[model samples]
Target chain A: MEEISFASQLLQYTITGITIGSIYAMVAIGFNVIYNVTEAINFAQGEFVMLGGLVMVLFRVTLNIPVVISFPLTIMVVTVVGVLLDRLVIRPIRKPSVLSMIIATIGAAFFIKGAAMFIWGKDPFDLPPFTGRNPINFLGAVILPQSLWVVGFLVAVVITLTLFFDRTILGKALRACAVNPNASSLVGINVQYMILVSFAMSAAIGAVGGIVITPISLMEYDRGAMLAVKGFAACVLGGMGSFYGAVMGGLIIGLIESLGAGLISSGYKDAFALLVLLFVLFLKPSGLFGSAEISKIRKF
Target chain B: MKLPAAREALPSGRTCGECAHCSSSSGIRFETGRDLPVKKSKNSLHLIGFGLGLLLLPWLAGHVELLGHYMDVMVFVGIYSILTISLCLLMGYAGQISLGHASFFGIGAYVSGVMTTRYGVNPWLCIPIGMGVCAIVAFVVGAPSLKLRGHYLAMATLAFCIIVTIVFNENVELTGGPDGLAFIPGLSVMGHPLDSIAKYYYLVWGFVLVTLLLSLNIIRSRIGRAMRSIHGSELAASTMGVNVSKYKIVVFVYSAALASVGGSLYAHYLNFLSPASFDLFVSIKLLIMIILGGMHSLWGAVVGAVLITFLNYEWLHYFEEAEGMIYGLIILVIMIFLPGGLVSIPGKVRSLWAK
Candidate 1:
């Protein structure tokens, strides 16, 4: 056996960090989408990711469907779940406060997770890598083929979202609704429809993240809570509603986690991200990219 | 500018002082604008009746074999009552939401459990020490987090809780890691070890009564009003000369201390401590207890705790795999249909009858 050089170790950590960070960014984006329009944190956001992974496994593994078909099928299934959540859990509230809405979402999360447990069972299920399991050697560093797939999926999401938000009329209307629902309604934009769209899109995005990461990290029913928390940490670090901020926050947390696990103790890896979250929150409540003035005005 | 003037002039609405028909000494009015249903003497009578009922519970259970089997469960109810009552004060009154209260409860359990096991410290003496530790930790955690409004504090507290649980899990040598600490000595009065379930039940209920009495006193005091004012509106509370941040921190500390006391009691009574007991799920369970019982009153806390403890420990065992689903459904049904919680049920029934 050969001794690995320090530079390669650093590169290995970087590769690992980027892979995990991409997933966190995806969850954070989902959080931001609903939060922008509703001013309520959807606590069940990570369950979409979990559903994506499990549903994909059901299609690709159990049914032996092709990856191409399974991917879209998984996303669609999760999207329906998101739509149902909006219709059933979210929409029916007569006068929703931030607290009530948050609690409702939490209940929804528990229900979804429990339902998944009943459907998928307590044991963790795995998805084979999109590509082969061969380790790719790059600049003396070893990276899994699936890590590349994970990073690629995140890139593809960002590009698609960027185009959707910038070029599409529906996207612009969604933005208008986010800016001010009352004003958007007056301008004839359907605020309720936009809210529904946000839930669908966020759920779909979360599904993709779950699909891509499943090969690397096994899919389990109860993993959503941890992912949601870490994703929330990314949101706070990146500035809650900022897209670029979510990306940066996710990557930074990933890097810290990987580097901390490698350099320090692996047992304390999760704590590193949370510590950074607390530090960011204490020093800068608005996050690095959010405006303090804007945060002060927002209800939740 | 005209709109602002109109809003300011719009009717101050029924001040408590303006309620001329009330015969109470203090000018207290219900939020629903209804007359006070119970007089001061009646309120005292209700308290006495509640105390007497509790006092008779163990004796009544001794004769009934089925009830005797659940004497331990009753003890747990008393323990959880303290935790829920404290949380009700912090969340329902002070308007500070904490998702990490289980951490304070955990801290108390761990502090007491660890100190007694490692240093051979007296089990009874460790209760205050655990509370002191929780108070300091809560102060440091609450100061910055409480400064932020809404879910930010909730998030911060949750983060702190996860961190604490992680430390409990990772620190193998000290905490005994995931296997948890065992052979924890039970508390004793004088030379008598509280070996029997009946004795422990009485002891635990004694603490619950003290906690309930203390909480009621606080709720009827000036500090409680200050807390309620903060809940209504922090800006308004501050303008009215209530030290908003100071009271928030104080209540936060107080709540943490009470949770610690519960934890300490739990540790001594069980004579075993596990990190799993202090996890995020337990924290959420505590939140559910307070929410289900009704957040607004001390008795509501006790009722919520007792019902939830029974459901979690007793009835839910029948469901097994479906337990989590049922618990989730319970939260949804209560939050959606009866947001005021189980404590509001009688009032709801009366309103329906009126209709």
Candidate 2:
């Protein structure tokens, strides 16, 4: 192996970090949406991502469908699954406590993972890169084309989500519901519908993340739990309901993980991110961008 | 249960309503009440009977060849019983959920395993050392985490569990990595090594009995009252002079210590230590056990541990590939239909029948 310069190594780590961070950011955003409206952190969010990749593989590889068709189909299928989860599992509980809902989501996550294992047979599946597998060399570092796809999708999703939240009436309605459901219902907003929409949108976002990252990172049945944990760490680090916070938290976590892997023992890579999570939680639960009042939202 | 009612019915010179902490709606009035001698005697009789039964269980199992297979399962049930009971104290009494309890269990196992295997330390010394380490780690994790309400605290513990698991798998020098450490020495008392299954059965269940007694004493004490108050309402608990955070942390530490003790026994019994044995799934399994049996009831924890252990070892094994599916389905069905858990089913049925 050629000995690379320290600067080049740092640059390479940054690129890899951003790519993975983008995925985490997407997952975090998914968590933020449902949490904002329902105050339930859907543990199945990562499973949706896993489903996205695996379902896409099923459509494209097994069924010989085109990538373009399979991608959207995967997102749609996952979105429907998310909606059904809310309808069947979350909605039926008349007096849903936060603890109960959390456990319920965990059960859903396990169910989805088990179903995935049965369907996918526990092996990792790969997707062909959108363009090619060739690495583009920079001044001293190299980057994959798939990484560009990941970064690009993340940027697009963020912009779209920002626009959806700010400029659209439906987005405003969702935001209103999130802020105060009783007030929103009093003002004639359908809080239930908004919650359903949030779940669907969150699942769709997670699916996009899963689909794009599959080419770079292979998909497996049990991978959802780890992704969910990392995403949750990102969500907590970013401030639970803040969108921009989620993005920033994801990037910071990604950078920490990649840099730690590059500079220290790769074996302890995950520990670095977890340490940051613990520190942030212990010292400042509100996170960098979150308001102090956000920490006081503990209902039960 | 009836003793509290009997105490409430006893008319003393003082009015029970005079006590500020007494809630009239709960039907249990607290006064300077005298102990019911008859009730005490009856309880002691029941206790003696239960103790006798527990003592005779191993002897009966030894004589019956058909029951030999269950000796190992019963030993594990004792281990899980400790974990579930501790979880019950935290979740049922304090209204806190921990998704990473397996980390404490794993820490205890590793600490004892490493000490016994690497340093050749006595198993007796290792158990307490493991409990101490687990208690400190629990304190550090719980101090910050207990401040967060509900799901966030759960997530924090989950993150901590993930980090611990990673460390177990990555730090090959300390933990034997994914392959794990083996040849851990069995536990002994006064150098009499508990090598046989029946001996381990007695040893584990003996600890279980002690733990249950301790837990029962705590639950019936003032500290338990404060914990129950916190579960009802933290703000109310604080207003009533219950140091809410202090009790939460103390209970969390106690629970971790119990799990650690169980882990030490597990490591010695299995004569091996692996990261896989104490993964996130183990924590979830423990949670499910407590939830299924009845999170609030002490005996419920024991029942849950035994039933779930049987389900995992016997029932689920038959399904093989569908294990996760069945496990997930059971949790969902229970949470949906019987949120009060198996312990409450009898009461629920009685109420329904009355209606």
Instruction: Specify the highest-TM-score model's number.
Output: 1
Q: Which ten residues in a row are the worst by lDDT in model 1 chain B?
A: B1-10
lDDT of 1 by residue, A180-241 (tens): 89999999999889999999999999999999999999999999988888899999999988
lDDT (10s digit) by residue, model 2, range A110-165:
88888888778889999888899999999688999999999899889999999999
Interface RMSD of 2: 2.8
Write one digit per residue (lDDT tens) for candidate 2, span B52-171: 987888788879987777888888988999889888899976789998889899999999999998999998899999999999999988999999887678778888888899989987
DockQ, per model, reads 0.57, 0.52
TM for candidate 1 is: 0.95
* Native contacts, share recovered per candidate: 0.54, 0.57
lDDT of each: 0.86, 0.84
Docking class of 1: medium
**Local error of candidate 2 at A298, Å?**
5.6
Model 1: CA > 4 A from native: A1-4, B1-42
